[model samples]
Target: MPSSGSYAMVLDSTFSTERRACRFSRILIDGGSSINILYRDTMEKLGIKQGQLQPSRTVFHGIVPGLSCSPIGKVKIDVMFGDKNHFHREPIWFEVVDLDSPYHALLGRPALAKFMEVPHYAYLKMKMPGPKGIITIAGDYQKSLTCAAASSQLDESLFIAEEKRLLDRVVAMASKQSDMPTDPKSAETQGSFQAAKETKKIALDQADPKRFAVVGSHLDNR
Candidate 1:
């Protein structure tokens, strides 16, 4: 299971369906509720009117599903949600509710029940009660460390390539300094050649590391 940090998401408090975007720190996930809830203040900022709400219900608010969260007053636009690859580009439906205090929105069970069903480390304290049973969940940022594992290999490769390229540049510059003539014309030529060699080495480092390393290892290689 991924840690809470792995799934830690930041929501914009002042988001626009069209223009004038803003972000908020108040975002919560609630498995107990059936529908996602939005605060009146946020809705107003987005230029969404209460009249647009669809007839739906929870203890605090009514449902406005399928219509999409759009900014109507300023410009025609859509509010988007989700992560890099797995995101809901379609305007997500939100219900307008009169929130007393403490939260801007609640991500109800329906919005993230599936992902929650999987085992996960917690970042905060939360509870859930459903047809099967009731479960109390703890939240923590620990899972974020595991997420790093997913990209560890890629990071390692990039680091190695970068390191090798830098090392090759250092070596080439050192060699050029040692081999260059004191004569002005020949010194300029050597410096230019040295710069070109460094550029080629960096490019080769990105495309084919082994070849770059082999060539950098010998005079005949470049």
Candidate 2:
């Protein structure tokens, strides 16, 4: 992989639905992936009802180093490939995940092995056996690279979501720390709030020096 420029190619193609009415584009055939992932949006677009998806508790990682993804469910989608002259339909089980990606579906090792397909990255082609003969899926390099460039947006979205969760946790912890503790010894170890452990009473109005409420001394008079 080149570090500086966007000069990478992939076996990106499209898969047709069982009805052959709709085709899901921006599909990536990745041999490196261990599980086939179907984007939630794509599943919906395919008219796959929620009732069709079976309960799945499988959690997987690798897209993001520190993040793990738990798919909503899994379903077997009849994927139609090749042309009218020689087409093949295969039922592939895909884990439905809620992720923002340029690709609609990711055909992993499981799917590749299921189809007994061979992918040639250099030529941007995928060959698999069909009823009549061998089916070849050609990838458009320019379109693939365009989609690949937008692929990083998914990672950025993931990172943004993760950061929000972390920030929410910190806010919750801060609220916990601000609460009054039953015992002084049991108070949480506070770090950088800069809040005074003890409060003092200050005059609110100079006309009536007694008009005051017990508040943190660090609080602004305004």
TM-score for each predicted model, relative to the true structure: 0.35, 0.72
**How many steric clashes between backbone atoms does each model show?**
13, 0
User: Could you tell me the lDDT of residue 56 within candidate 1?
Assistant: 58
**lDDT (tens digit, per residue) of candidate 1 on 164-220:** 999999999999998758898887776736433432342355667665432332244
Give candidate 2's whole-model lDDT: 0.76
Expressed as tens digits, the lDDT of each residue in 1-222 for candidate 2 is 223223333443445565434666577877889899988888878777777789998999975667898998998887766766777677888999887778788889998988889887776778999988899887767867788668767677778989999999999999998786757455544433454677888787889988987778678666
Question: What are the runs in model 2 whose C-alpha is more than 4 Å off?
Answer: 1-20, 181-222
lDDT of 1 at 53: 59
Q: What lDDT does the true structure give each of the candidates? A: 0.48, 0.76
